[model samples]
Target: MPLILFNKPFQVMCQFSPHPSRPTLADHIDVPGVYPAGRLDADSEGLVLLTDDGRLQHDISHPLKKLAKTYLAQVEGTVTESALARLRAPLDLGDFTTLPCQAVRIEAPAWLWPRTPPIRQRADIPAGWLALTLTEGKNRQVRRMTAAVGLPTLRLVRIAIGPYALASHPLLPGEWQEVSPLEMR
Candidate 1:
C-alpha cells in the first residue's frame, strides 16, 4: 500500500466522514481505498497523510511509533524565549506530561493564505510565529501547549510528518497528489 500526501486546508475535516456543514476529505480526495493515517483538526491546516496500507497507517498515527510532526503556528501574543522554554519542558496537562518538544519564536512569513473566517484580532494586541515540533499528538496538544504558555494559537499548519514534507508537495487548499516514493520509512 502506498501513501499519498495532502495539504489539508483550514475548515476541511480530516476524514471522509461528513459534517452537516463542513467540507471533508471525500470532497477533496477522490482516490478509492485510501484513508487518512492521522487527523488534523478542522480549525488547523496542512500535511495530512493518506494511505492504502493499514499497517502503514498504524505506524504513522499510533503514538507508540513516535513519528515527529512539525508545525508552524501563528500565535496570539509576543512569544518570549521563556515561553519557548516552557513548551520545551514537561507540560503537566493533568493527565500526562506532554512528550518533550521544541519551540521557538520566529518572524511570521508572508506566504500563508488568509483563513476563511479569520482568527479574531485585537488591534492593540500582538501576535507572533512559533515553530513547534512534537512526537505524541494528544488532542489539540499544540494548541493546548501554547495556551498553557499564555500564547493562544491563532493559526496552525503542520509542515511535515516524518520524512514527508509540505514543502516538497505544496498543494493549495482542497488539493492532493499521489506520493511516488517506492518505499516509506
Candidate 2:
C-alpha cells in the first residue's frame, strides 16, 4: 500500500473532487487511488496523509483509534498560563466538549513557510503560537477552543499525525512524498 504525506497549502480543499472556487488535492497530487486519511479544513495548512489502503485510513482517522494529531496555531494575542490551563483541560464548545489534550506555548517556528496571502496583522495586538495535541478531532475545534480562551486563531497548521511528523519529513506547501506503510507502525 502506498502512504503519501502531503504538505497541503492554505485555501486548498482536502478532496480530489473539483470545487468551483478553490484548489483541490487533484490539483497537487497525481497519485490515483489514494485518499486522505483525515481532513484538514480549506483554511488550514500542513501535513495530510493519503493512502490506498482502507484499513490504514480507517486506523489513522477513526476517533475510536484515538490517534494523536498535533497542530501549531498562530493566535491573535499573547498566550497566558490561564489560557494554557483552559486548553489543557476538557473544553466545552457548545455542541461537544473537547477531550483533554496537551497544550503549550511555543515560539513561532523559524522553519514555518509564510502563508501566500499572509494572515492579517495588527500593530497593537501581538500574536502568539501554541502547540496542541489532541486525540479527537472535531470540526473547527481548535479554532473554537482558542477563541474561547480569548485568542482568535489567525492561522493553523497540522504538524504531525501519530508517528509521522512534518519536522522529520519536511515538505513545502503543496509538496508530497511517499513512505513505506511499515514506517507508520
- Find the candidate with the highest lDDT and give its number: 2
lDDT of 1 by residue, 113-148 (tens): 777788888999999999988998999999999999
104-148: candidate 2 lDDT, tens digit per residue? 999999999999999999999999999999999998999999999
What alpha-carbon RMSD in Å does predicted model 2 have with respect to the real structure? 0.7
Model 1, residue pairs in steric clash: none
Q: After superposition, how far is residue 154 of candidate 1 from its true place, in Å?
A: 1.0
lDDT of 2 at 65: 92
Q: What are the per-model numbers of colliding residue pairs?
A: 0, 0
- Candidate 1 Cα misplacement greater than 4 A, ranges: 181-183
